[model samples]
Target chain A: MALRRTCLAAAVLLALPAVPAAALPPGDAQRGQAIYERCQACHSLARNRSGPRHCGLLGREAASVAGFSYSRALRESGIVWTAASLDRFLANPFKAVPGTRMGYAGVKDPQERADLIAFLAAAGPCPE
Target chain B: MRDTITSLPRRSFLTAGARSTLSAGAVLLLAGCGGNKAAMAAAPEDDINILNAALGAEQEAIAAYQLGAESGLLTKPVLDLAVQFQGHHKEHAEVLAKTVRDLGGAAVEPLARYDFPSGDLKSEADVLRFAAGLEKGAVSAYLGAVPLFAERELAKAAASILGDEAMHWAVLRGALGENPVPVAFVS
Candidate 1:
């Protein structure tokens, strides 16, 4: 009877949406770390290296990344870089910004994109 | 259905039917050779499609090159640029053919006859106009295919090649005393 009750409780939780860690896999934070290397070319996690210092990029306004020459189209357009928006843009930059200079065609795999997103989420928002 | 006919063995009947079927198969195989020969003579199917588009672009370029070569509109320096442009197109076809082969695909041979613009051949201006149109079409075709390719490397390679085509357009347009970028952005 106790086991049955436990199974029933698990099922109910699984059926719900917007559970913080429920939908996400226990992603290898290490793999996510490695994948961030590729992104480092155009983005910087420590300090603004090539384009923008992406340390606390999450929850930040897309237009406000400092010292980067963002396309005028992107700067004027009010798109914020939340987890969802970042994933969509990483899938295809051209689709996200039709005429912007980010020429990457995007990583196609969902899990990889997810892992990368998770890494960015962990990176936290940039220091004000 | 006579009982006397049933006395003959099933084995003989099966053997006779098999022999007749085999003969019929052999006859059909011989008749199908014409298409097979043509297939052998021409390129493999996949490469043919890629090159058919490529060949059309190269032919247009050749026409423009010849015009640029013959016209006295430009000095030696500009004429040299025209020659280099023509050479690249010729080499592009060769390299693309090799790429198809490296990927285990066949390369297409050019067709015997092609119909190009016959309306005007009188002046340098007419030739430049034709060249510009050809370059525009080639750029369009290359850029159009970039999104269609699914493979990661192939998509990047297509984009890289498309960039060259764009440069060619810019160069040719400049040669004709037109702006390299008449329009600001290409989406």
Candidate 2:
């Protein structure tokens, strides 16, 4: 009876979707640099344009950039940039923050998103 | 002498003697006044022009939403959402027109008919895409206009409208099963 119960539990576990050991896939920063070209239309490493500068993106709070106008939704959103957070945001930004001013369609490819995240992570740390 | 000065008709007196000289002097006087007026009006004139352009775009948005609402391609929540967005555009148009009037400019009227891609709007998805495209264009246009306004208040108002347009664009993209906010910034 115990053996049958264990087998049932194992089967149920197997039936569930596989959870990845890591939230993000292995990314190539080099490839991500190329992907970052699309972001250049609004963002820059040094100065704010249509969007805020991205030099210190990782570990930064959303809408924290000085002097850049941000949407009320993003300004109120208590999001801190992290690998997992960025992965989700890069996948579907509007879903993550409903009224955010970002008009992008999101990167659907997990690998590409991972690569992009990696590139941003490597861009630099948050300013002191 | 006083009787003669008072009895002479003003127009006849000016025209009877030295007509060419009087005409030239009058022209110069008018020209001087006109140039000064133009200089003083230049800033507001620019704001009015920008406001009129914004009004025209808002009118276009209202019409586009009307088209989507009547297309039979949308149903339920989507139709309702389209109507709501149309209301927003109407409000935008009203504000823009009023601002133009306040600035002493004639607000531009909407085109009798817009040249939307009617051939492409065959399905609900197509309609959504069309609306999304317009919203995106509106966002970009407002972004460009925000900095051009001489009135800081007008620039702020435009930025506020731009935010609304960006939200609409995101919602339309969401309806299309696309990532609504794919980018970290609106370019």
Candidate 3:
């Protein structure tokens, strides 16, 4: 019962509808640019490759892209891409959104994750 | 079922139960267990039905873990997580049951005694492998539902659980000398 309670507490904290403020330092988009190289292997701003393109990722509901074949978990996650969500997810992809198909293990460092999200938020839309 | 859930704080109960897993033992347990077919068997079109299906999957996982734990195949880390995983499933079931009931749907009652096949328990490694497979299936199950829920909240909740299942899969896979995360995409 004690174990059960602890686990429940953790999950509830994760599920709470309203997100708190960003915990890490404000992101450095320039630093994030350097960090995005790893992500660029599979993700790009304009076109989908092995992973879905990252163009205009901020404020988007996960897996809302028209043609990409996102995993059901991503489509159903119901998370809007806010800074807090992105930082948490980038730090640990599987933990933030379990069963996600995205291959990246996670960023691990808080600052790097913030920077990455900063870069993503600034990625803007693909050229028509 | 209603009584079991009402006693605890709902959010905590559900999340904790998510920690538990019914695992492969469910597949094994399904060989003989039974439920109130009429009340629990939900309609295909029902939004609650999807939850029921997920609940059923979690129940199966609980039985598997219970059987494995009692069989004494696991020691130290494995045993601890197996029990923890079972607790997670219990939370999942508890939360789903309440959600259905709150929405004017029947809660699916789990079988009284899921007959888990005994011979499958040979070694700790074997137990881990079985658990890993269960976690993997769980990931797939939740993944499939991501696009099916009419409400975005339901999808998010299911996705959250799927993430936990995926985490379990990775740990078990790594323990068994397999590549825990073999692919970029989880599917």
Candidate 4:
């Protein structure tokens, strides 16, 4: 009886559901990676991050890029960095936040959008 | 100076008229060639084709922007950013069209409608997710095409637009509180 109970408990513990890896919120990372290529012309993934770095971008202050001359709108938007907000801005810069220095059209595909966001989220400054 | 009235022969007058006509014809011909030269240079066969692709991409971008703006989930600042992008797309399209015309080529009409990505877009979060992916696609497409452009002017223009695209991506990522840099370009 004791052996049976121990075996049953172990089985139950093993059957617990595993947490899902950071699922993409909406955008597709593969496509987002490609779309992000255009950005590589002006930014770097490391260091001072000219124009802006893709690494650790989410949740950062809009005016945080040390050497970049950010537009007044982005600098003053007073919006906290978050995945949701980032999606809005990416979808349509003018629609999400007018007068922002960054000018680009929004993404069209929903899944790709989620994937991109998720990728960024996963790559974000590893939760401090 | 003796006042001798020497009436030039009719032949001289006729010859002068012929010379004037010939000069006028030459001027017109040269003008035509000049115009053609400019047109030809603007849209050499390769440039015309490349500009069309760029314009097409811009149109696609515009359509995407319209969809995102309609969602009403974005803030005012974001709205402005989108508008700027829309404007740039429009300008890009116009420039490309002009180049084509200068090159004696027909401008390709933009797509009447575009197919956006679908699925699970039930809320504001859904919309943002969609936007992110779309932006990535645009960026990637442009990057791939950049290497193929021959004119330095076109390349520079594309590069400038691309720089802004990166900024837009970073801003969006920043808003999401995600990492701005997706991949390091450095080896």
Instruction: Note the Cα lDDT for every prediction shown.
Output: 0.54, 0.68, 0.65, 0.53
lDDT of 4 by residue, A46-70 (tens): 5322135567878786667665555
DockQ of 1: 0.01
Name the runs in model 1 displaced over 4 angstroms: A1-128, B1-48, B70-75
lDDT of 1 by residue, B1-187 (tens): 1232334366664575432322222223222321233432442332233433454356556655766687665567767877877876775655555544544555545534333444564556566665666666566555544553333233444455566667877877887799988866432
- Of candidate 4 chain B, the 10-residue stretch with the lowest lDDT total is B1-10
Residue A28 lDDT in model 4?
59
Lowest summed lDDT across 10 adjacent residues in model 1 chain B is found at B26-35
| Residues A1-128, model 1: lDDT tens digits | 66654554344233323324343444455577756655532244655422456777777776586555565545644557766667666666545654344434465665676787778778776666
DockQ of each: 0.01, 0.02, 0.02, 0.03
Q: What tens digits encode model 3's per-residue C-alpha lDDT throughout A1-128?
A: 65654554456337533435546678888898867755532355775543567887888888887766665556666677778877767765655665455534467677787888888888886666
Candidate 4 segments whose C-alpha is farther than 4 A from its true place: A1-128, B1-43, B118-120
**Candidate 4 docking quality: incorrect, acceptable, medium or high:** incorrect
For model 4 chain A, give the 10-residue run with minimal summed lDDT.
A12-21
TM-score, first chain, each model: 0.71, 0.80, 0.81, 0.64
lDDT at B59 for candidate 1?
Answer: 51
Q: What are the candidates' C-alpha RMSDs?
A: 22.0, 24.0, 16.5, 23.7
Model 1 has an lDDT value of 0.54
Per-model TM-score, in order, reads: 0.41, 0.48, 0.46, 0.44
Q: Which stretches of candidate 3 lie over 4 Å from their true place?
A: A1-128, B1-45
Q: Calculate the i-RMS of every candidate, to one decimal place.
A: 17.1, 12.5, 14.3, 13.6
